[model samples]
Target chain A: MSGSPGAGRSRIVTWAVVGLCLGLAGALAWAMLDLPAPSTRLPGQVAAQLERSGVEHPVTAVLLNFRGYDTLLEIAVLLLALLGMLAAGVAPRASAPLGASSMLAALARALAPLMVLVAGYLLWAGAFRPGGAFQAGAVLAAAGVLLRLAGFLPAWTRPGAALRMALAAGFALFLAIAALGLTEGALLRYPEPSAGALILAIESGLTFSLGLILAGLFLAGPELPRREDGGGTP
Target chain B: MSLGLFYALLGGGLFALGLAGLILRPHLLAKIIGFNVMGSGAFLVLVGLGSRDGVADPVPQAMVLTGIVVAVAATALALALARRLLELSGDMVLPGERLRPGEDDDADA
Candidate 1:
């Protein structure tokens, strides 16, 4: 929290911080020096490339075909982080009720189902759009953040079997999908309707699993420790 | 390269700061926070590196994602070790208490 985080970080750390910021700025400048280069395309750019080459939807092409595996492991990382926090014995402190912020609560509650729907839509469109499990899950997780702030959910809940089940769902579903792929060819390869469907199925599990996992990791626990074991922390 | 490189640089700096915190923070709990911050910084760097021009590179991203998980695993293990150390000695060990482990573990909660 201090300039250097220690009791006395010294002039050295102060200089280090300044140096670090400058270095990062320099790197950014260096990267931008070669702007508009063929290798500096954004997500949309790659999609455009695929479209020129006959890909139906560039977004979908990139998400499903280009980096689907990355999407899968993103969920995995969320789960692992959640589990690690629990294992670390970092419990959440009790939260006061949402109290009079009914407006915020109402807004969040109204938004929850809608957000989930959007996440679902994104997952569905991952094969042909900018959205994917990551975006979807982050949205869902934000929903949880909303619910908590609204007093609809507890500040923190102890980790338990339910948590484990929820976290593991993505991995389990992925394995199942991979197995299905193997039935036709190698693991995770779909020889069916198209890449879109494959991505959709995977995205569904990913969205749900990752949303809860990341939310748990971020908001479900207290900065320090907590009381009860596991329960409806809400 | 532009955004990715930028984030990677920022992440790397944050990581070094966190590492210094981990080294300097005397309290056991604060140390954990430092470690978590370091973990986050590293994750950002990994994610940044995973980015590609036009195409999202799945391989590096996947590996980075897995690396985040693995880092969490190590963090958990370290926490467990810390907890045990605290329990045995009734006091949290300071970071610089390396040469004298048993001495500092005696502090009361």
Candidate 2:
């Protein structure tokens, strides 16, 4: 291993280190010295217009009305992620080996419910406040991860029709709303006075589907066999 | 572009770097690390942009809050995949070959 030893190896190592440092310096310099202007006038401009028109929950309005199409796509992206996980032959982690360290078990007991509560709060806050369905779903999934890690939850739960319903709710509900647009010429539009409520409703559905889909993806495959095996019993 | 512009560009660059690292690194776990870097970078950019008038953009910050969750979900999924790969392969880590199940025990002994 020491045949060519000091010279060749040291020279290469020295250059590699130098190159990395130089790259870092250059990147940092650029980021620090030059920054861009905000092209973020769209939201503000829209909000102002909504405000002028006395629109309630302008942020919600923006999300549900002007940007409903994007929201629809975002939800679709999440579905695709779950579907991709399936196609890739990945599955949710087997339920935690259960009864691991007492510390983990105790932590799960205390944190799981608390995390769920926080997720609910975050979701509720999304309307006329801050935060939303995505954050809530993440929190819910995190809680699930904790329980799974602590072995409190089985690697796979028995599949039920409820799971299927929850999984499809977001997409299905959004479709119904968009259908309204078709019938009323709104084209996925939310009318005033109901925009906030609609956004909240859509978000709730999104939270449920998103949480399940993510947890499913993170759960890893064998735990929930492919459709051919009939899900849950594992 | 101002700092807001700087924020987006820098964040985008970091994300791109992270994405590149995730793809280029052969190790399964390294991809996760790259993702974390990219996620953090993007988050920083969003937050940076939010601080427009020396106060954060409530909207971007909130959206980023949502984004953190999405990122976490993706990470969880990737991790589960890595763990399964290890279990199926009987290798604690085929990624970077960095950590093996009993390597630590051997070192301690």
Candidate 3:
């Protein structure tokens, strides 16, 4: 198939890349095989201090309490990514009007409220089981996406002051709490008595802000017009 | 080998595959997908290694959860950039990269 010089060179490059990947895989396998046992076990440590960490679920405890600094920075990173997207300077195209799909609209109407309820459950369940702000926020975002698809909500071009505030609320609250913790001798060190309540409050704010941010990631982008619709310039 | 080791090895394979895809693919969207594949492989490695001793470790699991949310955010930003490029240049491939003859036609299509 390499009939031309360019094709031959491309073939060679492909082979080299494949060879490099194989070597990487081999090296990784070798490293794993020769790995020494870790000196400290984190899971045990988490379990030992679970009582003081606030949440019953170990993962939740680690995320919202033990390593909360990471979560705080993560929320900041999410907001930054959204900000970058907004600053990319792509003009918002008009959203396509929904066709007569009453079934889809009805389905979205039925599911939206249910999804909101599920998100709430997930938020409440995070204290004891394998559910948390992230899952809850994701569900809420999915609902928003569905609503947009069903024509109940329109694509966002520019967010208003309230919307912007809503988007930043979670990160701001997290930072504030972390700052307040400085008075407690350490960053994010919640008072033991109110740790659960504090974590819950944080999760609730995160769920609200994260939901908007995640949905905005999709809805903020301009929708491409269909070619057959005569929307493109010749 | 233990289950954890097996998963770790699988993750290594996935990482290698994703690396190849990221390097070899010409389309920006494909490159983004390749990047996601690489991220997933790394997440698998992290959790697998942490639990190789048979105990479920919450630290790596929590980190992976955090990584997932960040990955979604990154993917969204990347997609927005790609769409902007498509709007401005009418193609998804970056400039200066030579497209195979048939690939150019595909891009126009």
Candidate 4:
């Protein structure tokens, strides 16, 4: 490749950008230098309020109960991104073998099931501990990506009606719940006795949708072919 | 002086580094990675700010968690676009520098 006329100008622009970035960074650091450690106002009250949300994990309660609106919008945003990818008209990569070693395939086979277990565990533990729907969904999606990379395209890579439904399930369920909550005088306000069940249900839907959405994104190169197996496991 | 402050400063640095990468790099993929770095920096800052009270704030933590999911979604979209651009143009660099109209040759490899 030969150097172009713009190369010199681009170099100068790059240096100027670098200087600007450095200055911005320094200014930000200096501005925050005097802030007190551990903000004076903690989320103690918010944490205490979690008991009323019918979940043991404060963060989970906050995400699914107190601030369900944000979660709802977030799921929507994820779906929107997936739609953008699909609209790009890129075909999924060919089904040709990924040139992976048999050992890698064997490893994927062993880990795939284990990943499911861990994801399930995380989803369950989210009600009481540090795990939640997003973490679980990500793990499940990682498993799918691993399988895809290892030349094990699940029979459902195509953006068929069923796959699309799964992708939309989380956002749809969340929106439904929010609408229902509106009838209860507050949007996303779950009844106390059923808050736990509702949150769990919503989380389950989210987990599935998020996993499928991620897998679809990973299969970005080609529009995945319709599975001949009619949704059966490969 | 607190650990949180240190992390916040680190977040600022990361943001700046990401900004520089985004601007200085001509490759679309590199810019995407830089965008992600910037996002993570913002997340770190949010997390640090939430920890201002000796106890971690669950609200901001939840926000950050949502942010992470959103960031990944955005990254995936960016990647898909980058891949598409590569497929169409036979190159992955941003258009302004490498793809001036009427320049048919790959001037700079």
Leading candidate by lDDT: 3
Report the TM-score measured on chain A for model 1: 0.69
The positional error of residue A179 in candidate 2, measured at the CA in angstroms, is 3.4
* Chain B TM-score against the true chain B, candidate 2: 0.67
Poorest stretch of ten by lDDT in candidate 2 chain A? A225-234
Candidate 3 stretches greater than 4 Å from native: A92-97, A223-234, B104-109
Q: Ignoring the other chain, what TM-score does chain B have in each prediction?
A: 0.73, 0.67, 0.90, 0.86
lDDT of 1 by residue, B9-59 (tens): 677766766766566545676678788887777777666655624345544
Structure candidate 1, residue pairs in collision: A60-A127, A60-A128, A92-A222, A154-A233, A154-A234
- Ranked by DockQ from best down, the candidates are 3, 4, 2, 1
lDDT tens readout by residue for model 4, B32-103: 989999988988888876764456779889999999999999998988788888778879887765644433
Instruction: Give the per-residue lDDT digits (tens) of candidate 3, residues A1-234.
Output: 359998899889989999999999999999998999998988889999999988899999999999998999999999999998988857755445443266767788789999999999999999999999999999999999888776667566677799999999999998888788898999899988999999999999999999999999987855444324321221
Badly placed stretches (over 4 Å) of model 1 are A1-63, A90-100, A155-163, A219-234, B1-94, B97-109
Question: In every candidate, how many clashes are there?
Answer: 5, 19, 0, 11
Q: C-alpha displacement of B65 in model 1, angstroms?
A: 8.9
What lDDT score goes with residue B46 in model 1? 62
By TM-score, rank the candidates, best first. 3, 4, 2, 1
Q: Name the top DockQ candidate.
A: 3
Say what the interface RMSD of candidate 2 is. 5.7
Evaluated on chain B only, what is the TM-score of candidate 4?
A: 0.86
| Cα TM-score per model | 0.58, 0.69, 0.93, 0.87
- The lDDT of each candidate is 0.60, 0.64, 0.87, 0.81
lDDT of predicted model 1: 0.60
* TM-score (chain A only) for the predictions, listed in order: 0.69, 0.70, 0.91, 0.84
